[model samples]
Target: MSEHKDLNKLSAAGLLISLGIVYGDIGTSPLYTLRAIFNTVSEGGQTINPMMVLGALSCIIWTLTLQTTIKYVVITLRADNKGEGGIFSLYSLVRKKAKWLVIPAVIGGCAMLADGIITPSITVTTAIEGLQVKFTHMRVIPIVLLIITLLFVIQQFGTSLVGKLFGPIMLLWFATLGILGMAYVVQDLSILKALNPYYAAHLIITNPMALVILGGVFLCTTGAEALYSDLGHCGRNNIRVSWVFVKATLILNYLGQGVWLLQHPHYDLRLNPFFQIVPEPYLLFMVALSTIAAIIASQAMISGSFTLISEAVRLNLWPKVRINYPSNERGQIYVPSINWLLCAGCLLIVLIFKRSVNMEGAYGLAINMTFLATTILVAAYMISKKVPRYAIIIFVAVYGAIEFTFLVGNMTKFFHGGFVTVMIGAVLFSVMWGWYVARRIKSRFVKYVEVEDYFEIISELSEDESVAKYSSQLVYMTNANFKTEIESKIIYSILQKEPKRADIYWLVHVDVVDEPFTQDYKVTFLIPGKLVRIDFKLGFRVEQRVNLLYRKVIEELVKNGEVDIISKYTSLHKHKIAGDFRFILLEKHLSKFSKLSVYERSVMWWYYFVLKKLSLSEEKSFGLDSSYVEIEKVPLIFVSAEDIILNRLPA
Candidate 1:
């Protein structure tokens, strides 16, 4: 829990960092949000009415107030897993409280990932396309593709260097938004009337096509979910304090855009409201700034995806992928497989859409679904904590209606490129669901043996002269949770298969807990100096490495005189030589002779396939050095095939 507390401090530095990381997606919305709305309202390339501008501004304001401020910053932020925030972190907290809660968790997680793909495509494309205003006939696609390719390629090297400049750049970006908006706001001060809620209600209630237009307006606050996801990075106090300045600047910019729209009612969609509001001489500079901001936003999304996949692997909802800690900074991870996959997806979206306006058709649909999923999980959590039922009901009803309306509005664009993102979400969800279910089925067949039944035999074996020594010390990785029990296959591997003899045998068990960044252990002596068991309780977010933890535990034991790891050889002991240690790792396979149902067979087949393709070797997964680690194959006999009738025959 102290891990999350570190991020909760309120300070000037924290606020600045929060500004850069938390607001990228939502902050850059002004670049294209209004243009998308105008395109939606008048399909025939006609000028948008001044009243529609007022209505659209009103909708954007209310949506931000209700959806972003009330639901996320105020309510959802309160649901923290020891200061860590995100759908997966929220899921870990409430999953034990309600069994079916995983459905919302998985859905929310997948939707957010799908949002990752479309967001970078649209944001980068919009920013790059700005150059088209001056350099007519210069192809935007090639430039956009180059920028995106470079963005993903740099992920492997980590972002700590470039990430430091993000805060100041974003601060300037917001300040620019405010100043530009204010300059235009004074030109037509009457545009401020959109601040009133009446115009928003009037537009949606009267306009026949308001629902379709609302879909495009939904993009204004799509990044609200990312704010909650990044809560742990900046802390609650820092985020809450920084949001005041962020929101104020955002509103001023929107008002400025509204004022500009009122004056130039006949402006083209290509002349985005965001850039048009800027001074004519600064257009090139603004375009450059927007591109940098968009890239920062893309970087945030990509990192978030890597974190989400890491958590999913720990929870058994996804396959294990290689996670690299490229920087010395804690929690900064790079997942190679996920990075390239996202790169491919982003490129596909850009090539298909060719421009930001077309990309808008697919953008908000996924994130709106994520918004609803977060609402459900947070409400479930509040109820589990015994918060007042009435308050929980109110929380659900208000956000539920707001998000549902957004979902409906987004559905208007379902066939018009919206299907692209939904299809991506479905694929991700299937992989997670399949992996999770298959793990549960495999766990049901695990068989454990009581340690008491073999304790005396193991003691005697240590003294036996007939058996050959495997090593001075033999260590095994086990799934057993209790000191008095171990996997049956371990007993078979020792007593029946090889008849291993050793001065000491170690049984190591790892338990992954719900907390983040927790790394603790307990030691038990099963047979005094002959055998021992070390139980490690690791948090889901912590790296699972037995070899490293094993060495630490050994060092502590030797210092305490609990066990001596000195060399067993007589001549080596006099020189104070360290004993040799070897580890045995088990890899389970579904047995061909087992009588499994068709469903079990199918799940296991896919499960092993996923593991082989996506994960590392058992030695690497355990962080064991290959030279000291030996791997053995074992069969998982869920149901023995008694149906296979065989009789004894003379040889």
Candidate 2:
């Protein structure tokens, strides 16, 4: 195991960039949380009581402190996967001993993705809703949809362009929050008394409506998962250090709102309380700034969704897709399909809810479920790593009580609007889980062929006059083991139809492992000319660059005197270089069988159909140039037991 490195090596500017990118979603919570809470009360048209306002503000502050600052910033961020963090990162850390926990991990990931969709819709719509304060009749839903549409459109270009500006923009946002908050704080200093935890505890235990209020208050900390998920982008030290300033600003703003509500208890703060704190003359200008800040928050989540999907693909928890890492920087990625899916979801949410306050009912549950899942996974991780069982049990008992309470409080709002987010998460989780299971089953059924089986045939082909004259090696890139049908096609084509002999046949298998770097490469040789199997065990953190690894293997072979180092080109490929290397690609097609159930055959057909359309052919999948590829397709009939024994064997 490699020693963990300190995060101080990254410069201050880099640290700030990391914080800006990672913390944007959470940092922008002040824009709508207070306003949403106020709207919930104001809908009744009754005067807001000073005590209720103060109690709610106190709950918001303590929640951020205990949940976001203490739990996530102090403890959760420490469970990093070589500096990466998320449900998947926690899964990797603990999956060895507690593999059963993967179900909940998948659930958490789906919930996070669902939150990704609704968050941007609510955050941006709320900011735009504030615009109605400046212009009484401005349409909110259309503008919100437009903004979300633009957000998705720009995702394909990647975030590196806009990410550079995130730090400065977020810094201004925090400063704006602090200044506006302090301005209100000066108006009524008495509200500062509500900062005590006793006020929150008193309200929860005494106030009859406190349970529902707790559900609303939980909104303020919805961005905590965003903080944990983005830890890898910004190191743990940078995020932890930055949280001090961010958390301070959040607390002051909530307290300032409390102060304002205490004095203006009967004043109807309709749209957004954060915007209300600024002076009348500056209110319009502040609304404009807040709208821009909200858009940036949405943009941050759009990028986050892309990163999560990319990680899912690498882990094989999701289907294979085109994953492009836009920047050389680790964790910077772009996924076109997911970007569009989120855009569609966000637009639909805005059109349906039409107002941020209505959307608030749907928000807290998804994030709460995410928090609960993380706590469960992290506890399992601590136990797996040899932490004392007693310590783990006690930690779980305390955190479990707190999280379960919040989950139930949030669950009370299920029919109130939580069903939308839950449904979205359920659909996504089903698709991902279904694909994961199908892949595993398909892998088990497919047979792998040994390299030794082809050696004798290849040796015989080498004796042919037509094959001996060709100066190229036949390299096949396949995921199938020795028994895969594609292997037989390569044999038939080379020995029967074309009969081209080559100096070497390289059968390569690339297994994507869940680590930063693979410990060793396993090489198996089946006597001189018959077969050779080389398994490249790559770490999860490592990029799959075929050419680099291929060169290293060749060098090792030469150093071991298996081939002449000076005559490598001729020895491996008969004589010529460059165009002389011919990569033979045998694609397998699974024919339909009546014996299998309709659903199973349909799924198999769909897999093959989708693979043919989206996945690269064997040549491209292997990273070979088009000019070097000689492709061949083979159809394999998979006869089900029912067809062979029951139907075909007549009585």
Candidate 3:
């Protein structure tokens, strides 16, 4: 808790760390944003339109102010889940407010993840493409692929070593951006007029391909969602403070690019303005620096992806996958499956879109969907906070109109490789939706009975010398939320399946709460020492390491004389030895002949065949020791046998 507080506290180091993690995506936007916009407005053999240039620069400036600055940093940052921010974190806070909100939450999360794949591809490709200015025959694809491969490969070992360099390096990178842009901006004070709203409005009204140009303009703020997603890593205050500097540099750079366009109206449109602004002597140094900065940006996105999936799993919106803490750094995790999958996706994207110019459309389209999803969720969050009705309407109206225009503009790129990311988002959303609904469908058939009903029988069986002793202590995981309730299948396993006796029976229930790092538990001794129930209230970010947590609970219980762990055997009790603990993990398999609707069947098919197959087993996921665990296969009967008709004569 102190560590979390430290993260939120305002300090110079905190601000620098925020710059390293939160601003990478947006900070590096000058690489392709202006280039993409210029390419869009000045296609073919025409000199760049002066009004279009001003309008694009104006659009870029205001977009950052409204979308990135006010909407995310000011308003949405306050909608954090215990210092955590992201689509899943936001949903966790407001999910109970509206059941249907999950649709948009999942949509937003999937879109952000899709953005992760393309971000690495586009950033590295654009940075490496700078080399082409000096060596026109250089191949950028292989170099980009090699850099990405090494980046993903290092995820397993962790980045703590090199992560320290990120802050100072990005500091230099942004400083360089400001210096380079400021140098050119001073030459033409007239370019400052592009920051005006009139130029932006004029361009929209005059340009026939306004949507297409807006698509290019939207690229300037593509990293806004990423900034929000990383709110937990660097606290809201740190991000807000860092953004002041980051945004100023970004605006200066764009304005500088605009100034260059005006001065060299007849220069080759193929060459990047960002590169053109730098002195000839410093181009190679700038290229090297940009490449390193691009890697930092990619690293941040990859880390964000891991955090997103981890939260989704805990929230039960995604399948359980293996998560490893490769370093002691706060919130640093490496997901092997996610790592490889992202690598493959990035490599494929690089191969398909060899030039950064070609990837602009896909990148804009993907993140635009994410922004729209985020807008819906932020509005929901505001409503939950009881913000004024008028305020909510105005908020919705303003961003809704702005983001909807961006969406329509991005749609113009659907054929130009935008479908790739859209398709990826669709697939990801299907997986999340399927996993969530499958759990709901399975829950419909689950039977819960009062634990009080079995108290007498369980106590009797514990002392029944005729029955063989199962173990000194036996534990079964239950899905019941109430202390008095236990799964009917668990009761059957205890008394009906085999009259197994034990000194004590334990039922553990894990409840994932909305807060990010909450860890609390309640112990209820239903039948003295014979029957016990432990309810764990863990936050969405906490791992359910039941075995270790249970041990800690028992230590506290024994300290307070709540329970005993001494062996029941006369020979071992005298030695002060602990009793044997055995866990029973009930694995549910869908019944072959169970009845279900087409939609239910399809959801189950996706859950079981695809998600479940890829996920870890319950014991491993819950951090249980396999040596002390036993698996019990249970058939999930959606439609019971009583529902079927049979002829009496046939029997």
Candidate 4:
């Protein structure tokens, strides 16, 4: 959606929409959070008791308070770029100020994506695991696999129909969580005792597996970033207002689950407290509701991944792949490569781990890395925005320690499938880093020259009737920032590669800016009617449709007396027909003859590999039609070879 969506309204409808899109990830966590904690404690050989339950409940309450409430909703939400908010949005704001900020942005982006894999695997498996509550011998893996596969397959069609149902369904989901949780909660009013901070502290200090339990507690807030990422949709007012109700329901449910566990100290750790708290008649109904909500949660995760990759491509942090907007829904996109890749990951985790309890170990850890990276970026952003230094210090110190402890606790999970998410993050980060570094290296070598020096030559060639006419109109996509500056290769291409003349020369430059939705252009008649320059200042998120935009610019120029577009041929000029325009695109290749360092060689090797495999050619990427385009290869000389040794004697 356009980041400028009007989400500031406090109306009930806004809140309901917020309930659907914004809260899906965090709202559905109750289905599996306690179950994961119990599993972790049981596997750690720790005794489960009322004290432990109270402590765990207290930890969940405070974590939601400190991590989700204060840090993200209150602090990070303030860092939105115009109306868009995400790592890339935040990075775009501060990246110009700090060149190195790209590192953390890529890290945060990749880690968030790695977390995407486990969110679906764990939440979907957990909801399906509820089925075993009715059929003890049911094989849930097959069921989970089916659900996961269908989710991916339907992505191509888009989710407009079912997506509309998400709000009412999630509203129902949260209401049910409150009602069921409150029922058990009233059974023992004393269960409210867990709300005290002492129990949470006691659990962490006295219990041996407290850190592991805390790791599980983290799952409850893993989707907290989604709340912020979706800020543009629901607006801060709607989200902040709705979060009050959502958080209350979530906390009550956790407390009620604690109450159930306290009463049944001998309860099997594998049995879900979420389902058990519901009345017998509603057990099947509860499973059905949980499954639907889990799917919505998974949908939010998948959609967020698409947005992330799309932004990464725009920001040059990741390679460009085909982006499909199935419907006209803003921000609703489908990337086949990413979609199928995530589907395979979810399926693999479901097949190998085979249970939500197992997937939980692989979750949270990668998200914590995301949390930490965002914190780092936020700190830098705060500094850049001129927030008070003292306030920034306090903000950083408090969240820093909390997230680091969360990180250390989760570090223990590396050997136990946590390595999966971490490894995925590392690999994804490397590919992005490789792509980014290669660009920086190339920037050091690409040649630029003053177009003023070639203007006389170009004018002379244009009128030289002895030279062949290349086309009525000639366009070249440029890297030059100023009208006077042009790439040296463009000069060579016209003067040496194959000399040609044209009546009018068009230099089109498209600038991808930091904003999310900028599309303005400037035109300068460098030589009045004979030569013109069009500089398009487009936002990074904008599609690079230079062909269509160029046509539009030409029409404007023709109407404004800036230029004439009638063909040079006398017959076409009488009919008022437009001249033919051909675009020349420069394609760079790493020269086999050039010398390079090991790092430089590796970077270029992977850069070209990624270009061929992952990215569209400039002609296609820039919205140029192949029929009217010409591709010319240029050597990328990072370090030119020294003088060659004389071989005259040998010859």
Candidate 1: C-alpha RMSD after superposition: 2.3
lDDT of each: 0.87, 0.72, 0.89, 0.86
RMSD of every prediction: 2.3, 4.4, 1.5, 2.1
In terms of TM-score, how similar is model 2 to the real structure?
0.85
Please give each candidate's TM-score.
Answer: 0.95, 0.85, 0.98, 0.96
- Pairs that collide, model 2: 448-481, 448-482, 448-483, 449-481, 449-482, 449-483, 450-482, 455-530, 467-501, 515-540
Model 4: lDDT to the true structure: 0.86
- By TM-score, the best candidate is 3
Q: Of the candidates numbered 1 and 3, which has the greater lDDT value?
A: 3
List the candidate numbers ranked by lDDT, top first.
Answer: 3, 1, 4, 2
Which ten residues in a row are the worst by lDDT in model 3?
40-49
- Residue-level lDDT of model 4, residues 1-651, one tens digit each, is 433656565788889888998888899899888988887787777767888888899999999999999898889988877677888888888887888888888888999999899988888888888878889999898888999999999999998777888999999999999998999999899889888999989988988887788888888899999977887677888888889999999999998898888887778877988888988888889888998898999999998998888888877778878788899877778889899999998999888898787787899898897788888889999999899999989988998899998998888777888999999989888788988988887777778998888888888988888988898899998888888888888889888899868889889998878787789999987876767899999886777788999989888877877787788778999899888888998888876625667887887888887655677777877778999999999987655545556456755
What lDDT is reached at residue 293 by model 1? 93
Better of 1 and 3 by TM-score: 3
Q: List model 1 lDDT by residue over 1-651, tens digit each.
A: 555666887888898999899999999999888888887776744457777888889999888888888888888888887778899999998889877988889999999999899888999999988887778677899888889999999999988888889899999999998899999988888888899999999989988788887898899998998888898788888888877788888888998998887887877766778877878789899999999999999998998999899999888788777889999886699999999999999999999999898999999999888898898999888988899999999989988887888899999989989999999999898788778877788777788989889999999998887887788899999888788899999999888888988899999998878887789999999899998999999888888878899999999999999998888779999999988999998888767624567876777787777655666777877788999988888887765666568899999
Runs of candidate 3 with Cα error greater than 4 angstroms are: 1-5, 44-47, 592-594, 647-651
- Candidate ranking under TM-score, highest first, comes to 3, 4, 1, 2
lDDT of 1: 0.87
In model 1, state the lDDT of residue 570: 90
Name the candidate, 2 or 3, with the larger lDDT value: 3
- The 10-residue segment of model 2 with minimum total lDDT is 563-572
